[model samples]
Every structure is written in C-alpha cells, then in structure tokens.
Target: MTDTGQAEQAGGLSVVTTATDGIRVLTLAGEIDHHTGDQLRHALEVTGTARPRIVIDMLRVTFMDSSGINILVNAHQTVTEADGWLRLAAPTDSVLRVLQLVGIDDVIQCRPTLREALAL
Candidate 1:
C-alpha cells in the first residue's frame, strides 16, 4: 500500500489520486474519450509538474477512444522530457486492445497492477 489522495468523481470519469515514494497514481473509472479527454489531460498535467512518474490505474476504464490515446501519448512525451515516466495499470481488456492496436503498449509501460506500476 502507498499514501493515497482523496477521490473525486467527474462527468465521464472518476479520479482517485495517490502518491508514494515519489510516484503519483491516478485511479481512473468510466469512459475516456474526446468529451472527457481534456479533463483527464488537465489532471495529468499537474502530475507532470510535481513529478511525472505517473501510474494511471485504469482498472475501471471501460472504454477509450483515440482522444484518450492522444492525451496519454502527449503525457508520456512530457514525462519523458522531465526525466520521469508514465505507466498504465490494469487497463480493461477493451482498452488494452485499443492500446495494442495503436502500438501504444510498446511506447508506454503497462503494468498488471497499481502496486507493480508504483514499484517500477
């Protein structure tokens, strides 16, 4: 277990934030698409400021569109530029499929669990 942040729910998704050992984790739920991509991007932007070692727990993310992928890819670039990294944790089967299709799984680190992502 790690230090956890307060949880908040939004229109298309919910974010449960946590951080420990210099890593920040965002547990996400619901759909991620064009309509909600900006919001998610904004939340992730804050992580980029403090430390871009971000782990996005996507266990509850039922769906993701290209917009979601765009935001995540951009975040990865930012994190990498800052000497940090981004990880995607426990994405749903469908979401993982999309990521694989786009070769994003190769570009970004994907972990089986939040704990695993944090450990990395």
Candidate 2:
C-alpha cells in the first residue's frame, strides 16, 4: 500500500473527494505540476483502497504538466491491478492535451462530466 497523505504541493493544487452513487470523485484544483503530482497519486491510492471505481474531476484544474499525466497513468494502472477502474472527468483542454500526448486518452476512461463518470 502506498502512503496516503494529502500535502499541498506545487502549482497550488489540492485534492479532495466527494462520493456519489458508489463512486469516489476526486476534485483537483489548480495546476498539477511535478511537485503536486504526488498529491494526486496519494489521493488516487487512498480512494482506490476503499472503492472499486474512481472518478477524478479535473474541471477546476488549470494546467497539467507531463508529470501530472504520468501520475494519472500510474494511478489508472494501480486501480486496474486492484480489480477496479479509474475514470477522469472534465479535464481542462490543457490537461486533456497532455493525456492525449501520452496516449492515456486511449487507455484510461474519460467523461465529459463528473456525473457522467459516476454514472459509468
């Protein structure tokens, strides 16, 4: 199990969860750069421990560097390996572009909204 700690990191991003219809929805706000990526990773791991399905709400996010994308990919793999699924919701264009660039758009599930992701 990974250490689950929510500490403020770079780009001023903060991660928090809201549950709806058996899905863990993690809302990420601010920029998710290299330093802040760790917080994202921890949030995913923490959520994955309690739920079988994970939804990450990225609408409030303003930017995401490659490191941020990497954390998402790693979290996806972690959830799948745990016999669960991870979905991304409402990613900003900049973050979406990074995910696409890393070919994550093809591997991970993404939805237009958090409600859609929770429904899935």
What lDDT does the true structure give each of the candidates? 0.86, 0.78
TM-scores for all candidates?
0.89, 0.84
Tens digits of per-residue lDDT for model 2 on 39-83?
Answer: 787777744265378888899999888888778878888888778
- Model 2 residue 91 CA deviation (Å) reads 0.8
Model 1, residue pairs in steric clash: none
Model 1 is weakest, by summed lDDT over 10 consecutive residues, at 43-52
Stretches > 4 Å off in candidate 2: 1-11, 46-51
Q: Which stretches of candidate 1 lie over 4 Å from their true place?
A: 1-6, 46-51
lDDT of 1 by residue, 86-108 (tens): 99999989999999999999999
